[model samples]
Target: MSHSSPASSASAAPASIACTSLDYVWPDGTTVFDGLQVSFGPGRSGLVGVNGSGKSTLLKLIAGELRPSGGTVRVTGEIGYLPQNVTLDTALRVEDVLGIAGTRAALHAIEAGDVREEHFAAVGDDWDVEERATAALAGLGLGHVGLDRTTGELSGGESVLLRLAALLMRRPDILLLDEPTNNLDLYARRRLYAAVEAWNGVMVVVSHDRELLERVDQIADLRGGEVAWYGGGFSAYEEALAVEQEAAERMVRVAESDLRKQKRELSDAHVKLARRKRYGQKMWDNKREPKVVMGERKRQAQVSAGKHRIMHEEKLAEARERLDKAAEAVRDDDEIRVDLPHTAVPPGRSVLTLRELRLRHGARVDGEFELRGPERIALVGRNGAGKTTLLRTLAGELDAVSGTADVHVPLRFLPQRLDLLDDELTVVGNVARFAPEATPNEIRARLARFLFRGARAGQRAGTLSGGERFRATLAALMLAEPAPQLLLLDEPTNNLDLASVRQLTTALESYEGALIVASHDLRFLESVGVTRWLRLDGGLRDTTAEEVRAEMAGEG
Candidate 1:
């Protein structure tokens, strides 16, 4: 269903994209990148890095959304950029969002025989703009959607696709997509993946989606304000990274050994020099030779001792430099370490119950579910299917439309927005608010495991990066009073990078409780060892990961 774009044609030479001596500094005095240089040729390049490593910032700079402090981004052709979070006016018609309202209106006027010079000018060369727009929507699996429909009528995932359709209509030679599949459902993700696969232009995508990354021609790993190029897709990139890390670690070990050996040699040199000085002084006091001969011997000995000391010092300095260089190659991404023995539920216990549940939004979900022990349930459904509504109802944040949802155990719900945290409070203060009984020392100790040590724990939550905020929120929930025995998470990996996702997974691994997670990430759902899968359409139905994948594959 995809419409052919002008930029999709292959040529003898590839398009050029380069940024030289890029420098960016935030208003809050935080520097993201300094003197960074990178170039991307025509092909799919998957940009990846840990959270807060300036992946989004770099995209913005290239797209002209943000200006670099000092540098130039050169692109040989037209560029189309899709930001991470797209917010369209709810009242705006789909045509307006697609940037073709003027052209469509002109065409309509001409068809009505009111053809003015301005209308003709507006219609210019895009006589088939409406058809192109329709095709673009249909290509993304939104075939039923029309141009006159308002944005509010579409689901969150649908809105994302609509924005992407607008970008595609431009047919830019270079495309910049920033976390395009963050909140997309399985069907929408597959549609997006298909579009990526068909893209023949230069495409730079910043995402943690494994499936999407696997489609890329190369991976540009952004770390320590530098880019490391790896040929092929994410899997190949990971293999290369593993080899590099192994070599780096070996160099570190060798450097450490050399440093230790140099230190010992320097110490021995100093001791020998001291002994020679003492012996020389004793010989001089005894006057074993003439004064002139003794003076000559003393000068020679002093010169020899000085040279010996200088050589050992120089070797020690070189060893220290080698150690520092070796250490720079190793990455030390933090991991959450938690022991939640108190949150354990007995195997026979009933954790939750849902009886004829209906959400306020008119979605009737009737089910009877009982959780025993630490059963992990994965909630899968399309956008606006009432997954978040159900989680909120279970957390007592909202009232069920008709039936009741009773929680037999202490529960905590982590919404996608992460608004539960008080922005005014520090990380330690927020956790303390949840657990007032815990002492300051105890809270600090717990926060340390969440990778907020000392001053970082005392900083305001609003100042933390996306990954840090997630860790802080997770810490608050896990360390809350009564120890949450039933944990609810909604799209936990929506905004997290791959490393942060792994960290969150590690945190959940130690959590001994019944868990319910609403997510569109199939890989993540599988990674969490989900015990059950529930699809929320009109009602809940038992499903499997394979079925979900098969269903998406069929739709695609």
Candidate 2:
């Protein structure tokens, strides 16, 4: 295939951006990027990778927030960036927030004085700015919220949604977003996905949400400081990765076999050399005698030649040993294994039973509800609907000022914030601390089951990404032998990527224990087979999943 010239390619590519031989280094001497090259055009692209694998860094480079230490990053048109955490100035009202952005554009227009009416028309007519902002907010489920509401009053999920609204209103030539779905509830996430599908410009989203990634046309997997672009969605990328890992394993096996064969040959050669040296020594000693010395001269010459051959063989054997060591090192460094342990716990007859449970904080009332379970229940509601509060109360972490609560079983809780873990310890140490009775080998074995093996197990818990830390916590829980009969989880899928979430779902499906989880991830709730829905307000109400879904749809 013929390649286009750089100038032509830049001109012809639609909303294209490129980074050539990019390199970035931290002040602490960590090399985050080295000779990175990536390009994107008009299409849906997903940046998928493990945490701290430079996905966000690469996005920053593309957005021009961070300059490359070496190489060039070029964007042909406007770029909009949605960071993972958007902290809007609290003093500004929602209208003022968008107006400020519009004013900047108007200023740029005025300064240029070359602005056409079409420029303003693109943003809005005389009142176009307001119209555009309203439409954007509506698209993101924030339409019902007043434009005069202070950003400070918004929840984390709401703030994120507003930021997304602002980005959509801007409508840059290329969109760069980091974890756009992180704070969005299921309704909002689905809305965002639909909006992206309808967007005309090139989009590059960095997210761990598998449902979102599955919609992308391509996936750029950042692994080991390099980007590997796969031409299909998450499933295709997974299949390709499986193939690549298999190939790596095959190489390791072949290399090990070769090393073993080389070692054996070297051993045989050493034996032969020792035997030859002994024969030469005996011949030399015998030939040194006076009377037979003349006749033994030929024998002596033969022995001398044999000694030289043995010495050469010894040199070859030494080189073989060095080669074997190198091969062994390569095999050892191939890949890190993740082995997670299965800690299955049986459920009690009545793991959790709530009778006329009413959750209220002063004036706010959630629900007057009742429930009994050995069943998996999903607690879901809007951003501030008290789902989390209800779970906390049920877990006995929160003091219930009213209502009767009954728990007939042991429980383990995995909070959204991971409060269960000590951030200061290593992965292994954290597991050991949690389950002190477990032996070192047993701990390592359990961690390996959770995909924390080798050096990963030794990594500080504080240094681990959200997903890794969660997995470590799960591993620790599994070491409990008789696992907790009841599990209460709060937004369990918050920071987990698509793959990890799927794995977790698979494990939970097979679990025979009772569970009460609060989350906004519809896909996850559906996958884990939630048998009942508990809707939260000022109090808890027993509702079907369908009803909750309808309520959310109406909100949209």
Candidate 3:
């Protein structure tokens, strides 16, 4: 259940956050925000936009990580921020990590005399600290884990929950979370959504999770450098967008009609004037009765000038009207399209064969593993358990120190870090670089299909947001002339919003190739139809789906 605060109370005025005429410009002369004005208040709010739409950048501005180039961004109360993906050092234990904040709060409360001396004595300083830490962890479903367990030893899902626990301990008035559920497992993601649903404070969440958005009070769509605040959740926002797009389309049609009419009228007037001129020239060349012919020619010329002026004015007015309508239509609805080439690959009976394969980092070793073709597999383990290393070896990016690796078919890999991208190039340029055979126009067209259009296509890869870079890389891989028969992905959902991840999932579901992915996102794994799992501890072992679900439950 959600908690009620004074802001939500009947007598209190609704709390509001506002950005007034904000403008943000990068060092490279790119303008992300221009005269942008947005207001949000108590309850959950979603920030939605395509990749490179400055969603994360705007979140940072609100968090004070950046200052607006021209206007102001102001918030009424304390702000709590959760970044998209972050790694905590393994040296710090969960309790010690949470203690850093609890200790400070305890000291502040004591300094302020919030508790009496006797009360303090009854609850030992260290005891109270541990109690508070435990409560925080429990709230986030991490209470069962040993307090001394190193943060770095946690899995991707565990780390996300812990970070949220830490954020919650602060109890800020406004929470600014950027893709809070990016790396969470299915159960963890649901829990995170519950946490957001339970929050009473004002929250501006930058995420692509449709389910999460469904729980929000409002959705703020960031598009074309502006923010549109919808009164309801995702469904309502989508309905509204559809209505707006329809209206824009109607305006475009009207504009086109007016333009055609204007052109036709202009053409007719030109034809009439040319005919009169030709007649006058013929009379002059024939040297017919001078006075009568000259007088008639003069009269025709005067009439033609008058007609021309009237037609010019009408045409200009029509053109201006069409331009105005076109402008309105353009402003109301402009979307980037991503047209990924679907390459055809010959069906192969056996794509990959792993027979008693073992993997490990330098000195650490794991057990025997086996895999086959046309199978959907998931690799699950803690952070440093060599999940990525295993994928690398399977993809032939790395050589296994001991186990034999065998593959009978062509393969493609999408790494967690997007190592395939060149940071210096634009989104389109990067695609062209990877698929050098594609024409420049084809590359641009394809990039647009991925939602990198207009100036965004020109954005440097290093400067593109994490989501943008991922999309660009994925677009490049999928657009290859002959798609790989076996696809290997390591943490594919790392930086994507829930929506993008789902879209990608839909695409993968239709893929004909075999897939072996290493991810902490259980939802993504489930969405992609992972039939079997390879759990890597000291070694690899095949386990039932129920067993993996049990492990997740146990971790929680």
Candidate 4:
């Protein structure tokens, strides 16, 4: 919630990063960006798009981790990038993780009078590197973490902050962060938000964290193989997009009207031309004019009709083009729809009962609680607070240290790793594996509702992007035989893009079964209509979203 400012922004001239006529295609021939021209200058810009939309890939290309197949990517200053998955070596010391181990070692040797010229060279111009590293860690809310401690001792959230601190210590003119808050808790997320707000250089962050996006100076929306810029934060971008969508829809209606009018006019012209030809034929029958004159008149009439036909057809084609362009401007973000009436549990039926449950980590859930009907519970807690362990214990994946977790109905657990589906199997095949009694056609039809239609359903799970894989995994779980009446989801939104998160929320809306979702995303938890909020902190306690956010805000 609070942080001291880092040293001033990069003293170098404001960095400019741009992609010129960029093109990238996967080996399998899936084109992500084609002739995409985008430029970003100094300021915090949040890059957002649907999963599989190449947000991360763009960042990688800009950071020089990946090269474009065609075109030039230009960057002006030093760049530091923090990727979506931050994997720190557990054996490495904190200073090593910060990339200051050599400097610290040199300083120590100099203090101990080693009198080595190499030590003096290594310590050059970094006499205060230790203090700067400490300040960076403290700014990220890891003040208590000692530089000598091993990264293995840090929690998941702490590790993310530590990685971020390492990036900040470099003071890069251009900083690229991709989903930096993926593993962070609410507290750590706030710390990240503060750090983002305090950034003073060219910051390009690709994140689905709404709070973090709210602090950006602008939004670069990468969609449909192009980028659209909005001059403001997330909320502002939404407002601007909503206005654009409304205008686009209105244009579509107008274009449709004009197209219909053109069709009618063309039909009328045809009728009039037919009447004139008949009249001319009747006149010729009566010998009202010379034969040669009649023939000339007929030729002129044909030429006029030809011109009219061409003009009307051109008008219709232009109208159609306008309608198509208008329609393209309006986004069609279809959501996943599912129906599971069979999974419903009656109010009198008990879904889950945890009795004096003690987890492997010594956290005692010494409380008696029963979930009945279709009650949706949100399991919230700080990192290492036993949420995952509790979910695993309830799912029967792990044995509890003591007590019992009784499930009176068929249950399915969608773990954070989403390992339920076989990677080698097709999406339809995977779902069919879970529901052997179902016909192949039936499985394919169900997969369509999960947005894997036609050949998409037949693609191997191993080839699916992260979000698509999640959808397939969820489909397999929900479509499993016996139908899960009680579902346990652990960190469902951890790696999902915002659109995928919305899709998950929509799919859950149709689920009539009891649900327990362990998550750190308060917005997602609230969106799923959570009826009960339970905090797992060595004990199970009923809580509310407001209370949770208050604690995150340092108000509780």
TM-score top scorer: 4
TM-score-best of 1 and 4: 4
Per-candidate Cα RMSD to the true structure, in Å, reads 4.7, 7.7, 7.0, 4.7
**Runs in model 1 lying further than 4 Å from the true structure:** 1-15, 109-118, 278-282, 336-341, 360-362, 421-447, 453-464, 552-556
Residue 539 error, candidate 4, Å: 2.2
Which of 1 and 2 is the better model by lDDT? 1
Model 4 per-residue lDDT tens digits across residues 254-273? 99999899999988988998
The global C-alpha lDDT for each of the candidates, from Candidate 1 onward, is 0.86, 0.71, 0.73, 0.85
lDDT of 2 by residue, 347-378 (tens): 43556656556554431343333344468889
Give the CA lDDT, 0 to 100, for residue 37 in model 4.
90
Per-residue lDDT, model 2, residue 93, is 85
Scanning candidate 3 in windows of ten residues, the lowest lDDT window is: 1-10
Instruction: Report the lDDT tens digits of candidate 1 across residue range 388-474.
Output: 778888899999879878899888888876777898999999999888999999999989987789777887887676667777888
Model 3, 35-146: lDDT tens digits are 8888878888899887667988888888778878877776666677787666788788786656554454565577678786654554454545666767877777677767
Regarding lDDT, does 2 or 3 come out ahead? 3
Estimate the lDDT of model 3. Answer: 0.73
Residue 507 CA displacement from its true place in model 4, Å = 3.0
- Candidate 1's displacement at residue 37, Å, is 1.8
Residue 461 of model 1 has an lDDT of 81
Clashes of 1: 0
